[model samples]
Target: MERTYSVLVFGNEENDIMLILKFTDQKFQSLSDFLNSEVHNFYTHIQKELEAVVTGQKEESDFGGNMLNIDIGKEETEVYYQMDDESLGEPCFISTDELYKLVLEWKEMEEKMRRGEDIFPVILED
Candidate 1:
């Protein structure tokens, strides 16, 4: 199956734009005001961890905490996301190859935004 990832812009007012990330059936959202904030850090951290897994620094590892947890494996990676405070949502598995590409795409989008490039409604399918 081809997995789809999208970045969408929302909100009614110019000052209220929100960034929405759609990954298959899941949606993660953030205020545009914080577009260059903590979320980027999380993505970068995950990217590094994924790289470590790819480079054989560790047999397996995990990234994220609290609302999200990614179990990184050699071939497959499990992504778990939760919006609620007390429970975790169902886990989804994607190939580590695809996850690496997705994270790189996200980091590229962030860089574009930082450079004042328009990146709304971006779609990545793999």
Candidate 2:
């Protein structure tokens, strides 16, 4: 069965942003486990990257423009950055609280899926 989870992306020019990050069941479990341990490290990395940008210690060329892209799959996990527009500034650093909330949301979704609920479904209208 197709398995996927999505998170609402912030720090963009347009609102109501959603990023549907696809992952296999195994990979999703792995990510859930990793988040339990390394979420802080993830947050730290983003903070350092933003700090470097502000201080000019690192050139913008060193990293992708702004939006942080995280792709996870059965084979591997990848994280990178991209700019939505020239008007959009640097990616917003996710605060610890926000990260925690995201983790909670992910876990809740997982649980709901495990219960065989339709987490996302297409609605047909006649």
lDDT string for model 1 (1-126, tens) is 233323444666543433344544432222111123334557667778888988888789986654566788999987665454323335567777766776776667656644546656566554
Scored by lDDT, model 2 comes in at 0.39
Clashes of each: 0, 0
**Best of the candidates, lDDT:** 1
Clashes of 2: 0
Candidate 1 pairs with clashing backbones: none
lDDT of each: 0.57, 0.39
- Please report the TM-score between candidate 2 and the true structure: 0.28
Show where candidate 2 strays beyond 4 Å.
1-92, 121-126
